[model samples]
Target: MEGMNGRSVRGVEGYTRWSLISLAVGEPVLLWLLLHTLHDGGSALAGPGVAVLAVLVLAHTAACIHAMIAALRRVDPDRGRRGLLPLAATTAAVLVAVVVVLPLDGPAEPVLASIPRASAVAVIGLATIGALSARWPMRILAALTVVVLALVTLTQLGSRIGGIIYLLPAYALVLVSMIASFRLTVWLLEVVRELEVSRESHASLAVAEERLRIARDIHDVVGRGLSVVAVKSELAATLASRGDERAEREMREVRQVAQDSLEQVRTLVSGYRATDLGTELAGARAVLDATGIRVTVTGSADGASPAAQDALGAVVREAVTNVVRHARATWCTLELGAPGGRGAPGVEDGEWCLVVANDGSRGDGAGPGTGVDAVVPGNGLRGLAERLTPLGGTLTTTRSDGVFTLTASVPSRETA
Candidate 1:
């Protein structure tokens, strides 16, 4: 008992430290002392009676061990519903052990006085383990355990009510101590398990927060720089058409803006720049809607590969910017969906599709066509394509009837 308490004090696993050690070491040692008491006190069992009692004790010990193991197995979450069978076996064994040691043939089969008390202790200890492993609201089992042990002790000690009064207090103390020890072990195990779960949750939350920070930094660095460059490039084109000297200066400004953006990108990448698909999608809808473009977003970003998510997010950012800065149309649709599914045409299996289309192409500006009628791919579109190529994806642009559409497709893992 001291060793058990000491091991627990030093923080050992509950089921192992308490249940295994107690059943294997504690029960045997206690049983030895109990059997010694029976022998020393002159038990008058002869021949077959002695052999029967020995067998019963062995069986009871085995049953108790099984009960302890079963209790430990169901210590957590399950609350030891599976331990009930072992508990019953152990209880039955204890009762049999009691009957074997009792004076069933009156004075001729008189047993040692200590044998019944020892059996009661064994039964109570098993009951304590059962109580510890069992789920909540086991008041009935607890009451029954106490009543059964008390009755068993009284029946065995027949006409020894004075001895019962003297020994009962010590037996009660033993029972209380057993119960308290088991409860403490169980509580400690729960706390340890909870702490482990909390640690894992904290780690996951930290990773998500870091990802969000990186995404925000990339957005701040890239989005502002790109939007400014677009506006300046448009201004430069207009000035050059009007034969203004400021056109050359505006072109220089555009070059400087591009250089600055390149530097910003390099710095952000060195700091591990990243973006979340969901965040980028939400931002695209907000920016496009504010620019008087009817933005319709469909599908979800869940279950997509991390590489694909990053690529699609970049596409969303670039496509929305192009529509706002260059495309002069009113309606735009963004769809992120599974490929080779309903409403999707020309998309192969194991692929996720991102389609951004706008009917805002200004005829006077660049519109999709060949030679003079063709709209050339800009820096944004080119950069987006570069990002997708490494992820085993393809990007294509089409313009028909003044509608400009950018479609991106990346392979995806099948979900379980």
Candidate 2:
């Protein structure tokens, strides 16, 4: 995805660069027409004068193309400096060509004189539009229209008002169209670049979020088991010192816990670790009972769909882990049913709900109805919320009196 987005952005940039270069190259064709006109009009300097003019037009075209490439690459920091030579060359060429051809006597003299000047303006405008902002090219175009009209009027001695009127709107329309095309292309290229950056940022965020998920899963899978192992191992050592026969059994239990934790970690890393609600409930009961905390489970996991069961199982695992590690309760109650009975807002009839409530909460400075925010820190419950939210579920926690309650709900297959 990242590579494709980057290539798309680069493609837009390449297309824009070539488009600007094409415009720059094509605009000078008008200068060639001016040369052809001079030759056909039988101007005396058409021989060497045309050659000089041709050289000037070629130089202007080369400079304009170079300026446009530089601007598109954004390599030259001083854009105005980069465009200076092209603008200067075009100005000198236009003045020389116009002055040399002004004395020609023909019905086409005024129109012919205006061609070199107007074409020079267009060439310089295309060049600077690439290097500079749209406003600079617009100013140059405006000046081109004004200069062309004045030259046409002065050359005809104001006797051709019809020609001036005809040329005014036509020149403005052509120049505006060209400038708009260039500006819109550049704008589109910029938008593509921004989209590429945004795509990269989103990819980075996804990576960070995944890392957080793995960390949370490791904690839920391994932390409480390690705590149990430590407690049992210490008791086993004491019982061994006392020559108790049960010490061997406790050590064996520790090994089993370690093995189970190792398997869970492997499965978690492989991304196929699914939690069955019934299995999770049994494990929660066994883990809590081993710690001398009474566990009561209500409601069957049968009616719920696999997705809802998996999500609720994660909630149960994390909640049980928190109860074992963070709370001092003598008892924990696990319940599963429809949230409609509990009057949970926005919960439909077919939604499966899991409630884990324990009395030994250490308070942890969390307030009542704190939802995900007031839960024990470290992405346990928060990660479960992240998991459930995409399934149209919610995770919330509340600390009231001496109990910390975690409630998770998800839609069943029928409702989903």
Candidate 3:
């Protein structure tokens, strides 16, 4: 589930709180068990032994409580070893108490009464440490605990083989359950850590992808604008050298191209610019006309939706930019049409198609074009294709008979 700030909330973050709750509830249960043990088992010991047993029980309880607190702080591996010290103290106290109060000559009732005490020994030592320690160490500690308990139980039961067999299984079962609980809680914490790392990785990937898209957009904007500026400035210089009267007008047009390119670059950097079909057509005509190319545009742009317009406009801009930069031909044609009409045969119905074709794309009758090969798409065409893919459109390029053609088609609906 998402948190208030829109980040995903981790269920595992509640682990420490739940652990405290379990410890709180388990605290009362442990107290009740201790009281019952003292009330019932007190009869088996004298006044001095009873006092010692109480002190031992209290020490063991305190040690277990301390270990549990340390376990919470033991998330760092460096602190885990420090946490184990308290659990070791708890184990020592439990073992000492068990040795002192063990009744070999007592009746079966006193012997049976000692079972709770033995179980407490396991719970206090094994449960706290098992939960905090890494898996391998936890297993080693668990094995040592089981072994010590088996020896203690065997000593108390004496020569009764059947009693030893029955009581050992009960002791093993209790210790195993406590250890398993600890392991499961630790595993849950590991899963939560992994999920947090995965979330961070996904965020980083998203940022990198966005950076790539912006770089592509900037390259398309600046590269096309600069291409036009270069062509117009060169044309102005050529006319000036020939002492023509129109050289001053061509220089003025070059200055205008430079000014427009600057404004477009500023809009692109600020991310407020949107490509429009009308604007692209006007820009294309001006750029091609300045370069002395006959630019003929034949299409009804009003029939296309806003999304189709943007996609087709981007195609037009990029294609026209390529014509100025790479294609050396004297004539360029741009056509727009609804699907399945005589103007756009082989197009699907209810779709809009844009066509940009130029004969100047052929170069030296050897490469794809005369001066530059327009058949091989630059960054502009690739970026245009990328933008169109998500809008259910396709950009296709083909070259034949020294002519390079760029076609872009999209669904007729407006995109939000």
Stretches off by above 4 angstroms in model 1 are: 1-11, 14-16, 23-25, 46-76, 101-141, 224-258, 269-416
lDDT by residue for model 1 over 1-416, one digit each (tens)?
21122223235455544554464445545555555555566656456755665565565555555545555552464544555665567556656655655443222222324444535454445544444432334475467557756665656455544555555566567656655566666666656555545555755886899899878887898888889888988998998899988989988988898899899889878545466788789988876654446789988888777778888888998888888777666778999886555434566777989899898765553433552244467888888888777767778886666777788888885233
Badly placed stretches (over 4 Å) of model 3 are 1-10, 16-35, 41-78, 101-111, 114-120, 132-142, 154-163, 223-258, 266-416
Q: What's the lDDT of the predicted structure labeled candidate 3?
A: 0.64
Write down the TM-score for model 3: 0.48
Preferred candidate (TM-score higher): 1 or 2? 2
Error of 2 at 52 (Å): 3.0
lDDT of each: 0.64, 0.68, 0.64
Q: Which stretches of candidate 2 lie over 4 Å from their true place?
A: 1-11, 74-81, 93-110, 113-165, 223-257, 270-416
Instruction: Encode model 3's per-residue lDDT on 24-128: one tens digit a residue.
Output: 346335634654655665536556765666666556556555555555542665554564665567557656765666444333453444454454444444444
lDDT digits (tens) for residues 1-416 of candidate 2: 22334446677888987876776677557656655665576645546766676666667667666766666663444553566676566756655665574342434565634343443443444444443433245676566556655654554453444545555566567666767877788778767766667766865886799889888888999998899999999999999999999999999999999999999889876565666789889988877765557789987887677788788888888888888777777789998885455524445676887888888866654454542235554678778888988898878787766787787888776333
| C-alpha positional error of residue 398 in candidate 2 after TM-score superposition, expressed in Å | 59
Instruction: Tell me the lDDT of model 3 at 395.
Output: 80
Candidate that scores best on TM-score? 2
C-alpha TM-scores of all predictions: 0.47, 0.49, 0.48
